[model samples]
Target chain A: MDDKIKMKVQELLQSGKIKGFLGLRERHGQVGPYLFTDGDDLEGLVVGDRFKPGDSRYPLNKQLMKITRGDPSGCYGVLVRGCDERGLKTLFGSGQIKSEQVVPVGIACPQDLADACECLKPYPDERVAGEAAEPRSFATVAKVEAMELDERFRLWLAEFSKCIKCYGCRNICPMCYCSECTLENKDFGDIGSLPAENPVFHLTRAIHMAGRCIDCGLCNEVCPADIPLRTLYKKIADIVEEEFHCRPGYGSPETPPGLNIRGEELKH
Target chain B: MEYRTVLTTCTYCGCGCGLYLEVMDGRLVGTIPCKTNPVNEGKLCVKGWNVHEFVQSPKRLTRPLLRKNRELTPVSWDEALDFTAARLREIKEAHGSDSIAFLASAKVTNEENYLIQKFARAAVGTNNVDHCARL
Candidate 1:
């Protein structure tokens, strides 16, 4: 599978189809994000599956934004898993990146990762490598949903109290692209204090992820406090789906119902 | 048009978390935790996330300062060192060596910290030495 990917990337770069290919590279037994240009060292190119489950995964879309912002006119190719493809769709719909400016080389995730993430779609829209695994159901979300109102509140308080205000969950999220985050505002969330006034800090971020989170589970993986952030955001996703009939990153990047509100006073 | 990431260790505390400093056109832009690092596993604290800011901050002191007439004034290396030595000697003579205390920073090397403790115990004949990590 890696050989096939390397061949395709080499063809793209040699044929001038893309200025660069953003993918993972393995060197000295360490895997990291690398931009392969001119295909001089295609031997190092590999799909991002070297780590075990629950290990931290790099936000490839976040890196894509950096490359695109620097060179908007330049066309680039990026390796995408199912979650990455959805993130790209979100980015495209929000006008963060032009669809024509990027070419995604889709790769399907294995069953282990698919089950670990409890993803509904384990394969990208376009697949060039690996077979699509069976979609898994959200057991964690179900467990949280079964709790009573007060129990849920108490559980969340206990979980959030362990927070160190590190912002790892927010910083690792690819869809959180706001230059001025509301969490940083003194009025919304307290500053220079640990725990950040429980529920306020976590709830504010969870509300923001209502229509944006793609269920990659990266936030939960990157969190140092081992908070069940994925389950919290999954509940928000469910609410958006049930209330507004909007499934984020399901199809094209149409505006989610939360952002599509048309106030009568502002209607032209 | 040039961009790259250099792997380095965080200097905020004793944990020594690993991170990659993103550089573009020779300017430090951002920091990302090293995923392969055994210590952090791609998780960074608030201090590590803002490491790039302090590197080129305008508020950071660029030169040594000495107090002149109750006001801090920029001074040469020789003047600053001479002033520090003179003050330490006068304090040790008047109140005793125990009156002065030495504080070491985590940012310095282990050898440097060892030298600082040595200076406090052997040279000054006092054990009033500590490190910022303790605080």
Candidate 2:
């Protein structure tokens, strides 16, 4: 499977189809994002096995943003898993990156990884590695959804109290590419204060992620404070789905329902 | 075209979280937490997230500065070190050694911190030493 990916990347680079290939490289017992240019060695290329269930996956789309930002005209190839493809699609819909600038080499997640993420689609649009695994539901989300309003409020307050305001959730999110974030606004949350004002910080971020978050679970993984941020964002996704009849990154490239506020009254 | 991530330890605190400094064309661009590292496990604090900012910050002091005529003026390392040593000795002699306090920083290594406390206790004959994290 990896051989096919390497060959594809090499072909893309050799044939001048792509200026670079953004993927992972394992060297000296370490794996990190590596950009393989036309003449660079592809021997070290490998899909990172750092995927742990319920842990944050590397934001490959974020890395792609960096590459494409500087050279918008340059074509680049990127390794993408299910969540990564979703992130890329969302970025495309938002016009952050042109579709022509990217060529995704998709890889499906294994069953265990899929179960860990509780993902609905464990396979990308195009697959090069692994098998399509069954999608699972978020048990925690179900539990939260069962709770009463007061109970949910209390639960979220307790969870938000543990927040150290590290902004890992925002920083790790591939879709969160705004230069100026509302979370930093003094009106929303106090700056330089730990546990930034309970539900305000968390809820504000949740609102921001309503149509943007792709449920990659990177935020939950990167949180030094064990906050169930993924579940909260998942709930937001559900809300968006129910209200707008739109699911982020699931359909063709289009602006998210939250961002596509046309001057029209709702039919309902 | 010349882009790479260099793995290194975060210098902000004693936790020594592992991170990769993203370099583009020999200039520091950003930081990504080292996922495989046992210490941090891809987690970083706010300070660690902004580690790249201070590297190129205009406010960052590039050279030793000495307060001359009530204004900070850039000076040679030798002059700064000599001045610091002389001032420390003079203050220790004038006021009791205990009056002078030494503060260590987490940005430095354990050995360097140890040397600082040792210098305070032995050279100045004072136990008035503390760490910045404690404050």
Candidate 3:
């Protein structure tokens, strides 16, 4: 771990790239994210844990961009787990954040956390810490898929019944950066009403996450109901990968397939 | 600029996720889970994100008021508190202390709430105290 971190640091500093690295550092006994400047400390840099909701990697990355936007010619290093990398890709594709200013320091998540996330990729194209793991399929999605239409609907209702409208899932997601969200629009559903208009809220969110969700599981972690939200987005992400021939944030810096569909030549 | 965020916990209870008044200038511009917080790790629930709305709200009480002769009249804080104390005392004296129940607000601080309960139990001599969150 020490060697891997040192090599990355050396390369980052030597290449004259990145004004700073934003990631967790061990402060006394607790670990918290830090902004490491070249002359500052690197002794406590470590990568571990996949604590959802508590993890501010996504928001910190946004803060870095916000802070460094005026310095157009500057760059910074960001720690990206699989979900964060995917989020960065989607954000770049959507023009929410710039790619040039970001240097992804990738970290692969553990299997238990990956399973909880139902992630398709456990690592980014680069690795600065830990070995990558083969992506695993989630049985929860399969189980939901296998259910008959009514049975699925019933199950979903039962699960969604517990929704307290905390909005934890959307707030914690890296890919869910919107100046204004449609879910809150009164036309879609009643404001502050429980069970949220029978799947309108969740389904709308699922549809929005169609080509956007990075399977971070932050939503699931923050959800008070312990709803298996991962299944919903994972299934949609899988469909996006299969049908669109693309995964969110993985392709070249091109328009999303949904918007750039061409003439009938490409249509079935 | 004026904005408000409602002070509330993550609705995904058990975690008791605390979030803030995401005030921008004076308006609640956006949600930022308190960074210095220990519980939330600077993360907010979806509900916590918009917590500021209920504050600075057109619906929120801007001034104390009292209903007199079946009509609400805007009143001073002194008048409101005096009226409330007199009413409670009358109720306790007439119908017994148990008849005058005290329901506390979750939005208030622990000290405020403790003082209220103490006043109710010792002064008013009623244990009919409950809270929005029974903590």
TM-score of each: 0.92, 0.92, 0.70
lDDT of 1 by residue, A43-100 (tens): 9887866666425367878877877877768889999888889888887777777788
Residue A84, model 1: Cα distance from true site in angstroms: 0.9
| Cα lDDT of model 1 by residue, B10-116, tens digit | 88877888887777667787787777788888789999988877888999999999888999999999999998998899999999999999998887778998999
lDDT of 3 by residue, A1-268 (tens): 5357656865786678877776655554445455666634777675645354224333445444443443555677877887778777766666666678788887777666666555677777888777677787777888889989999999988888778787877776666667568887878777676756667788888988887777777667656578888788888888888888877766765657564521112110
Docking quality level of the chain pair in candidate 1: medium
DockQ for every model comes to: 0.55, 0.58, 0.17
Instruction: Rank by DockQ, highest first.
Output: 2, 1, 3
Per-residue alpha-carbon lDDT of model 2 for B18-118, expressed as tens digits? 88888887878888887778899989999999898888899998999999999999999999999999999899889989989999999888999999999
lDDT (C-alpha) at residue A182 in model 1: 87
| Model 3 TM | 0.70
Ranked by TM-score, the better of candidates 2 and 3 is 2
lDDT comparison, 1 vs 3, better candidate: 1
Q: For candidate 2, what is the DockQ?
A: 0.58
Candidate 1 vs candidate 2: the lDDT winner is 2
Q: Pick the winner on TM-score between candidates 1 and 3.
A: 1
